[model samples]
Structures are given as structure tokens and as C-alpha cells.
Target: MGGKQPVTIMTDQCSAMDKAIREVFPKSRHRLCTWHIGENAIVNIKGVMAKDGFKPRFDYVLKYTDTIAEFQHYWNSLMTDYNCKTHKWIERLYDLKEKWCPAYNKEWFSWGILSSQRSETTNHSISRRLHKTNGLCDFYKCFLDVIDEWRSKENKGDYNSSTGNRYYSCADNMLCFHARNVYTIAIYLIFEQRFIKVIGLRCQRISYEFLVSEYIVGHPTKDFIRHVVKFNEQEMVVDFTCKSYGEIGILCSHILRVFIVHNVEEIPKQYIMKRWTKEAMNTIVEEGEDRDNEEYIGGVEGDGNVSNKYVRDETLLDVIEPSIDTVLPDVVEPIVEKVIPTMIQNPPKRKRKIKNGTEKANERNMRPKGIVEKKRNKLKGWNKRRERHVDNLREETQSTDKCMYHKFTCWWGFGSSNIFKFTIGSICSR
Candidate 1:
């Protein structure tokens, strides 16, 4: 293990561990983790696209030379358009600058931090062990129990999906709600193929009550969702906003995802009562009437019918707004968006064998990829064999058959010696 040291290091930002690594072998490629950048991005921006958009900028920061100038340009652009306040994430952002920017000339880090996600993930696994304990003091004990738990998860080994995405985590929403003097959670709803954004709001942390508002498609979900929470002082603002046909369509995962965040249980009845409103519940009685009646009344109708004034007043309640759950399918789509985009590409065709003549340009291109060259080389070999076979036959019939290879082998030295000996014997006998 000592002799077989690693040539590359892929790890999170750790000062002492990095120092130990350099002392052991100073020359090695050190790259930051990809998943760690995503964690940092989500901590700042708190959504999918902005988090995804950070990768290229972080990568540009990691180049060896001329990287500082390039990274400074990207860093400035990122800081410029970012909607969030700079105070909270300023330290985290600067940590990246220290690690990646060569001109900053910091030696505490040998390489860029690829990601801190793995280390944090390990920590999360450790904390789960404290689930056995009960009560507030157990929380502190559980928190302390996770320091070694990071590596324990990898040792046990199991599957966890949202374990990394952090979309459902407590930090997944915008912090601007606090600054705006309100807190909100909105459901992006689609009803009858129309877009309706539903938002629920709470005044402060400890309050059990929530005020809610609905917003139109023209507004961004973030700002309008904020308006819903902050403005809810009295009655629920149901169907407060509308969308044009262009804005109306199938709901994306983003909208559906928010509905899932705020479960149907937590949703107030006033919010969706317009949709699920029942005739029996809305039945009218005069303010002065006795509230209780025997159920045994037989075949009775209009002994004394209610007045026209009450009937006309009851008509206001007749306008039934369909419940949100019915519309939510329209929002989430009863069927997934299965209309996969397809291009009418002509498939590659099989090549017909050229029986005799030369091939055309179309035939050349249409040659069935790997087989074309293979068949061609085979045909060339067949022709070479045929030519040699014909020449061999011609040479065998002519006097120049010296090149003919007989199956038998005779030693010329032995044959000539026997001939000479026969001649000498004949001469001596004579």
C-alpha cells in the first residue's frame, strides 16, 4: 500500500488530510467532486436549473493556468444576476475561490473540491442511528452520534434516491419569504387544462393558522407565491388569478412537485371547497327556525314552502367550483406527458450484392456498414485464387512443368551415384 500510492486524488475540501497527502507525495492530479458543487449551488439558489447551471462555471474555475482571469469573469457574472442576498453564501463562495483561483495563491488546498456531498451524505447516514432515542435531549445525542456515521453508510451499502437531490429537504425553498415578512408554500394546479397557482401562507414560525392566495401564469411562481402568503388576512383568495390559452397547458414536474410538498391533509377546506362544494351542506335555514326536526315526517311537501327571497339568495351558493383534486389531474396530467418527440429519420438500409458490374455512389454509401469492406476483401481473394489456379494448370500441361510439385521426393546424389556404379560394373565385367 505504501509503494502503490495513488496518482490522483478525488476528495472534498479538507486542510489537514490534504497536508498529509502532500507530505507523502506532492505531485499528483487533484480534482474536486461534481456532486459537491451541486450541494453548494442548492444551498444558495434552492432550485433545479440554477443549481444545474453552476457546473460549467465551477469546471472553468478548475483549469491549471489562465484560470483565475477566466474564473473571475464567470464568478462576477454569477454574482451579478443571482437574486439572493450575498451575505449568507459569501463564505462558501469564497472557499471555492480559494481552492480554484491560482492568482489568489492559496496553498492550504492541493486541488479544487469536486464535492462535499459524499462527506455530508455519510454524516446523514450516521445520524439515522439515533432514531432509537426519544425526546429533545435525544436530538443532541443523535447529532453527536453521526460524526463517525459518514463511513458507516458505505460499509452497510443500500439504495437511497433523494439522499442526494435534496429537493425535499428543509432548505429547498427560497429564504426571501422571511425578508418579505411572510412564509409561503404554493401548489401549481391545473384545472380543465387551465393553469392555476395555489399558495398557502403562514404569518410567522409559531402560528398554526395559514392564509392563502392564488396567482396567474403571467407572474413568476416565486414572487406570486410570496404574495399569496403575505396577503392572506381574511377569506381565502380562491381562483384569484387566471391564465390565457397560451399559458394554459399540461403541468410540468415543477408544478406537480410543489403540490406534493404541501400534502392534501395540510390543505384547508376553504381553499378547494369551491370545487367540492355539496348541495346538502349548503342547504338553507332561516336564522329564527328550530335547528332540530324528527326524521319521521311522511310524504310531506310544501306544507309551508320557503319564500322567493331566500331562493334567490340561495342561488349565490349554486355556482359550484369543482374541487382541486379533480383539477389536479389536469395539473399533474392523468397520463404522463407520453408524447415523446420523434424525428422522421430514414433508417439505414441493407446493401444488395453487386452481381457483376461496378457499384453506384448510392450503393457505396448504402453498404451495410461493417459487412461491406469484409465482403469486398473476400471477393478480391476469390479472384486472386482463380487466377493462380488457371496459371498452374497451364504450366502443368506445357514443357515448363519443372515447377510442378510431385508428391514423391528422390535424392539426386543417390540416383547419380547408382548410375555411375552400374556403368563401372558393366565395364569391369566386359
Candidate 2:
């Protein structure tokens, strides 16, 4: 990314990848995939999982804990209850608690991604189109096709975001309106969900510093647990204990409730992530620096060995001039330009050769050749036989029906309704 490191990197349990990330991008926050950790736990602590109430308790400790103290408390309780303190995998997970545990790593921005499943899914899709027999060239072509499909999807998303009409749950809410205007379609929908959820939450002021006030927000009757939200009235900055904004770039319902209580009409600029915005792909170019020119210079100045003027000249020559080898041979060109038109204007007629009587007889006696022709003839003969059999069966059925009708009519009497019914029944039986 042009000498820039990622803010956070998530990968499966791989020691080599962990070490490489630490060495190469020391500043980046490296996290293990929670999914991989869970899978490993299933393999490592199968006995613990088999015990009653262990799985839910383990999940609570892994994901639902709000604070580090709570996480530690519950984790220790779980270990003591399950007698898994001596487990090697559990010990290793505790050692790397900040890497995979959300309670410890909530401060860092991760865009709500807890696993490297996105990359894995893309790899799976590409692998579906590939085989062991595929060469490097075939792999490259498949890769290009996949990339083109991704670009097309991105373009479609962009079009939808730009052209689609905004949906409003509460048309009068300025915050919702502002969010709908600012964020792209997908992000706006997420924000709208959170915004709508604010109605269910109750916010109470807990404490206040110079400009920042903390509030405890939760449902009145439904939920017992409450979340803390710190709001700066002067700067219009809000921070939720859940760190929903940090984790997913979207304000939590607790924070939105706090905003409503504080009479905040619009989301603060800092909280509106640019990546979620409609103009995310648009870059503001500097007044004097042209991006195309810079790219050209960068291409020419690669390794500092090539001259820019020489590169430009070569590029121009390649575009403007055709190679001598690409020109068609003069003799062949004349046949295409001259002979093709003459042939089209005066098409040659196929001449029928006169044959002797013996030759004609031999031709007439000749059997159809080729594997395809023989198969076709065999299929045709089988179909004809089937049709003849069907016709014979239909004739036999008709004769049986006539005989049944005559017998029924004689037994039931000619003009009676019982006769008609018996005849119909006999025909059906036949």
C-alpha cells in the first residue's frame, strides 16, 4: 500500500505468519482469527466441551465479556469449574489474550473483522476454478477473470449507492437524514439500524469532567447490563465502552441514545468514517502535481537506471509505429484484397461427374460410413421399432375395448343408463 502498513492484520494460527508480521510490520496490531482459535479449542478441549454448560460458558468468556477484569474472572471460573487450567491450548490462548480476545483488543480499529475468512473465502472461490492439471498461464487467466468479476461487483455497488433513493425509518430525525446523505447505501443501512435501536435504550448521566460527561445506557426492562458512553458536549465527540465505532466504524446504540439525550442533531465529522462514504474512492489531487505524470515518472524512474526521456520515446514509438514483421506478405495481401472479391462476385459451381452404370450401382449399394453415421442409423431404427410396437399395442387395446363394450352392452341392456356405466367401466378396465 505505497509504503504504508495496515492498521490491523488478522490471520489463522500460523507461527511463521505471526513472526513475519512482527518483524516486517512491528507497528501493526497483529491478531489471530477468532474462528481459528475456536476451532482449535474444539480439538484441544473436546472433553471440556462434552461437559454440560461448558460450551456456553466458554463462549461467554471468549466473546461476551465487556471488561478485562470480567473476562479474567469468568475465564478463571470456567477453568476452575472445568478443571482445564493445565490444558496447553488454554494456557497458550491466555498468553496471547490480547491477540484474539475482544475484551483486550477493543481499542484498536478492526472494522469488526474477527477472522481471516474473507481472504479464505476468496481463495476457496479461486481454487474452485483451478485444478492440479492447470498451468501457470491458465492460473493467471483465471486470476484475471476473478479480479474482473470483483471489479464489476464494486462498480455495481458504486452505481447503486449513487443512484438509489435513501430509505428513512424516521423522516424527521436530522441525524438519520445526515447519515443517509453522508454514508454509502450499505453503511447508511447499518447506521439506520443502530439509530432506530436508540429508541429502546435509556441513557442516564453518571459523571462529568470539564467537557466530557459519562452516561450509563441500557434497556429499561429487557436488559440488566448497561454500557458506558462518554460524550464531549463541546466537541460533540462520543465514545462508547463497547467501542463499536472503533471496531466497526459505526456508532453504537448506547452512544446514539446519549446523542439523543444531549440533543445532538448530526454525527460529528470524526465519527463518520471516510471509507464508508460515497466518495471513498475519490482522491483530492494537489494543485500542481498531476497523478498521471507522477505515475509515468515513477514507471520510468524504477531502479534509478532508466532515463525518463528515453522511456517516453520508446513508449511513443511502440504506440505510433508498427513492426515490419506484422505487415502481411504482398502476395497473400493481393489474394485477400483482389481474389476474394472476384470469387464472391462469380462463385464457382460444383460440377457433377458422369459415372458408369457399374459405378452408380456400387454407390447405391454402399452402406453409410463413419462411427457418427452408424450410431445415427442405429438410433433411427430403434425409434422406428418402438413406434411400430406402440402402434400395435394401441390397436390391440382398441380391439379389447370394443369387445368389452359389446359384452357390457349385451348384459346391461341397450338403452339403460346402467348399460352405459358398465360399458365405460369395462373400457377403463381394458
Considering every candidate listed, which one attains the maximal lDDT? 2
lDDT of each candidate versus the true structure: 0.36, 0.71
Off by over 4 Å in 1: 1-7, 13-23, 27-29, 47-66, 83-90, 98-430
Candidate 2 residue-wise lDDT, 22-62, digit = tens: 99999899998888888888899898888887765666566
Per-residue lDDT over 194-223 for candidate 1, one digit per residue giving the tens place of the 0 to 100 score? 111223222121122465422211122111
Can you give the TM-score per candidate against the true fold? Answer: 0.22, 0.65
* Model 2 TM-score on a 0 to 1 scale: 0.65
Best by TM-score, which number? 2
